[model samples]
Target: MATTTEADIHITKGHEVLKLYQFNTHTARHYFCSVCGIYTHHQRRSNPQEYGFNVACLEDVDPFELGEVPLGDGVNHPADRN
Candidate 1:
């Protein structure tokens, strides 16, 4: 996954097939491909100013190339505590 501001990102193609998913508090907007059911990106609940995008789902991106990536432990979401 990668992080970027909403204004910095734009789906050039296949955006028509993307569907929004909202669970729990519904503050975070998760988007996925309606046809393939692959996660695309999400407006982060932790930081609404940024979006977390699935690198593998994007074009010309090979997640394998980003070896030894560090990720957050999302097992305890801040919203869940509330």
Candidate 2:
């Protein structure tokens, strides 16, 4: 069981939550809640400061789910912000 908490979630911008991957950076390559087939958020390689969110989309997230916040940065983040 890959249970995660608010501390597990990376960042939140507005109403969107940021999720991350330890190895993968491709936003679409990661999967969320395979058991429930839910897609939360995805790892972002460009702005490693936070994960990219699928705002119009989400699933299986409880009402009390951690509100999205900001992430300082990630390990090996791209130097250029372009």
- The most accurate candidate by TM-score is 1
Model 1 over residues 1-81: C-alpha lDDT tens digits? Answer: 888998998898998999999998898999999999999999998888899888898778889988899876879654667
Could you list the CA RMSD of all candidates, in the order they appear?
2.4, 11.3
All models: lDDT?
0.89, 0.44
Steric collisions counted per model? 0, 2
TM-score of candidate 2 relative to the true fold: 0.30
Candidate 2, 1-82: lDDT as tens digits: 1223334564343223323335543532343543444565654444444454434343465534556744446564445556
Residue-pair clash count for candidate 1: 0
lDDT (Cα, 0-100) at 23 in candidate 2:
59
Backbone clash pairs for candidate 1 read none
lDDT of 2 at 7: 42
